[model samples]
Target: MGERISNSRVVISGMGVVAPNGIGLSDFEKALRNGISGIEFIPRLAALNFGCQVGGIPPITQEHIDACFSPLQLRNFNSDGIIYGMIAAHEAWRNAGLEPEAESLDPDTGVIFGTGTSGIEKLNESIKLVDAQKVRRLGSNVVIQTMASGVSAFIAGHIAAGNQVSTNSSACTTGTEALLMGYRHIKAGYAKRMLVGATCEHGPYLWGGFDAMRVTNYRHNDKPEQASRPLSETAGGLVPGAGAGAFVLESLEAALERGAPIIAEVLGGQINSGGQRGGGTLTAPNPEAVKSCIKDSLVMSGIEGAQIDLINGHLTATVKDPDEVAAWAAALGRDKSNFPYLQATKSLVGHCLSGSGAVELVATTLQLQRGFVHPSINSEDLHPQIAKWVPREKIPQQAIDVQLDRAIKASFGFGDVNACVVLRRYNS
Candidate 1:
């Protein structure tokens, strides 16, 4: 179409999820529609333990993970990053109907991953071994595996991506940021395609940091699944969750040339910052900044706000963030009556930090493909101040009668850095 030529568009050909709800995209969608929760309690952390539970993917045994890594490049992998990345990458590749080797696809395709806090548990364990006993007890590879970009680098090498490949450590916005970078690379003619997204494990140190912020919900010790009620009147705080979400992004031209089935187009994306020490706290998001980013995304995508039928929100059940987003929606003249049908994925998978946006993107892609918008469960009521802008009830599970032509996924991180991506249905 004429519109396709004016824009250098990229499409999401495949997606993968390794979250508490399930290990693959199919299982993830099923669980999301059913409103399943994967949160549970953990007794062991530091003394700051609130006994409040979290959404955690049960630990994968080393042997089980190693089987996927294989012998050739196993030594190069940092356990924390590469193990989950390989699993997700394989799932995505298979989901897209691509061979593990990338056959007809260009060797110059890139790879990018987002990671917030990497290998915190392994670092803590290494420190303990060094302090109590001896350095020999601590593994030699501990340092490499604990670094934030180790996983991204390991995946790039594993996949043999011949062009530019990198990682994003942009806190909560990392996954969206990674996707943006991939989209840009393909759009700018830098590469034909890229693998993008993020993965993280539930580590004690991350929870400890949250505890110090006095923001984590310590009151819900008995009910883990019901704890992360974003936008709910009873919602207390956003809990830390661990998981990986990834997507394969390719240029439309490249995909059709290779006979790849396109899922949805990556219409456009934008990122913005909220500036320095926001009133002494670094994590608060600014409403104006969030609005600006959304505006930019809309402009770049060449789409009207009315065309956005769904919004995958970054509805962290935090005190200030959700209200900020609500204010932005309100300022845009979107309220209960005219708001985009919204769903917060964290209510099901928990907040995966850097991995949250990508995981939610996979959910949205499935939504568009199947024409069904999943509900934001455990959030039956909204905070009085922001209730007018949020969808507080269960969304119907039936497939939408019309085509899902467009949607948006919003992600905001500490320091008010935000990223929004516009996704559109592809007409093959």
Candidate 2:
């Protein structure tokens, strides 16, 4: 951990998202405001006799694909993660008023897109071909599609970025970490702009492992929309989801000079791990580390815990939800009477794994910019333990209007990794 640079400020100028509930910014904002649930029944899961048949998948159409990919580039392109990443990245680049067809490379622009499993579907295809002694039948794009950094490489070319281009994977923390990495790159005077985000593929190949572990919700297959019940007592487990989210992060000065649309300010953030010690494990977070991560983030942002008006939490619908709430209460030194407005994006889009942090950050940014907190749907039956720390009204079931200034978004991944970022409403 290092001190935040004193001279530089980072801001999010533009954002793009491909979420289970919605495809673009306008639709996504409406979905969040309306408490729309993107979790639905996937027939393939049922056919495979999996314990959880419901999942969240973006409703992407052929037109959406055509808009992002040229016909030649789509040849044998079976990586859904790459497709979602490219769409979100392209939209973000254009949304930031950056030229995609520029003749010269952008020496000051970089990319840090990430994914947990880049192309399981393509890998599975290639495996079968090799096993059948038909290796020659494999397509030319196999390596690029299967590699972890494929998304970043694709975006680098699409935007003609000549600066640093790389991928990062930290279980579910990948997206939030990507944003912070970009922020640090600019703060250190390495780049003028960075396109950062993460994506996850939707399919049984990637979700089957969770189902086999019995960590996915199997009780709500009949009630797909209610499957992801974050903060609810009736919650069983997470409903797996997939999609991508992206942001164009620029220095405050550069954004102002270009007259770009500033969505929010990236004040500062903290990223750390529990080292799977002190009761932390491959699947659970260490309480102390979680608190320290939140506290350190506030310290870096130069704000007290009470200054945060909202908390976009990584409250996946599971037994750990109450623990996360308790950690926040301890870290902020706030009780039920004055805890900040808390909402769970997973309640609307399910647990998107590596993509969860980025997608939720987009939701958080929208709430801060628009002055409203979206409801934590399906949490009507709040858990008893969580109820002790947060008032019922504070966990809103419907969108509420409020003038928000400072908000925090935190993500805790499977490997006991945690990331917290403070964001403020942009003010001239």
Candidate 3:
């Protein structure tokens, strides 16, 4: 908390995203700008009798596969997580002007990609084959595709990452936590560039648990676009989603040396857990820990609560949304109109589960870089508690230009864990 602003600053040089609303950076940005909803009704989920049949899933094309994977790699490829991860990671790498081919592994470069549950779809496939006594027919790629570290391993090998190439899984916080972790790596001079992101698989097997738990929105099955209603009074439940988002985090000095476009500067961040105590449960966050996490993040960033201009929150369109806003207000020591402009990207993208933080962070970075705040659709009739803490106009249903010089992004996941990062416009 002392002289943190003078510490080694980390900056995002390149970004790539595979979202249900959009496929690439350009498409994603456009979708965000225009308030496009990616949540749709899946016929399979309905056929499977899932209570929540609508969800957000990216429309991946074969050309995208050909660009990211080789013919041999795709022969037995059954993991959609791998497909989304590679596409997003490769885009981030190339966006930073790095080529995929490397004559030798670079110790200064590595990856910290993450996923919550890997290859659930592939695991289901393997289970069926084994149950039918056709285990021999199971493809050799099954193991690699379903493993937790599969996404990181594939990208590390492709990029020739000689430094620490690894994976992290933290439920919904996987992505944002990875971003903070990678930033720490660069700050500690462990690596010059770390490609960090998170991907989540979709379909019946992955989302069935939530459906069974009755934590997903089933009321909007017919009106998919309106299903995910973060910060709204009528939010039934979260609409599960799947996608990937990635960024190339480079040391500020290294980015300047290489003339990489700095999208935003990571001032500092913090990751902590509430220990599932004091009203916190296996599925809910402890309010005390949530406040501390945000305060600590601000201290680490050497900034005051009042300096923050925007917030990209982990509002999953559940009963937790109001509680989350209360935590932010309490942590920042701000009330009502004094609070910074708040937004919920999940209103359009739905809750991406483990990938939610990363995709939302991408949206946050783009919002700052583009000098406009994307609309938080489906937020009409802000929940009474939330409205009491913030102005209604702050949560617009349409995009607007604003001087978003400083921002904070936070993600809270199951296990009562929280990760908060401070980002600001990289003004040289």
Worst 10 residues of 1 by lDDT: 393-402
lDDT of 1 by residue, 1-428 (tens): 11122235688888877787877777787887787877777766424454455545634556646645666555544445456666777677666666665434345578888887677767777788789878887665676578877777766755667777677888888889899988987787777778899887776666667767777777776788888887677888887787788888888887887888788888897998867444423677766777778878888888878678887888888777466656557534566767777777888778888788877888888888777877677666666766656554423323233457898888888866889999988876
lDDT of each: 0.74, 0.92, 0.91
Which residues of candidate 1, in runs, are more than 4 Å off?
Answer: 1-7, 45-48, 58-67, 71-81, 101-106, 136-140, 277-281, 328-332, 390-403
Model 3 Cα displacement at 406 (Å)? 1.1
Candidate 2, 1-428: lDDT as tens digits:
12323457899988999999999999999999999999999999999999999999999888888877788888998999998888888788888887775788888889999899888999999999999999999979999999999999988988988889999999899999999999999889788889999999989999999999898999999999999999999999999999999999998878988899898999999999999999899999998999999999999999999998999999988889999999999998899889999999999999999999999999999999998999999999999999999999999999999999999999999899999999999987
True lDDT of residue 15, candidate 2: 91
Model 2: clashing residue pairs? none
Question: For model 3, what is the alpha-carbon lDDT of residue 32?
Answer: 94
Q: Residue 306 in candidate 2 has what lDDT? A: 91
- 10 residues in a row with least lDDT, candidate 3: 1-10
Query: TM-score-based ranking, best first?
Result: 2, 3, 1
User: Whose lDDT is higher: candidate 1's or candidate 2's?
Assistant: 2
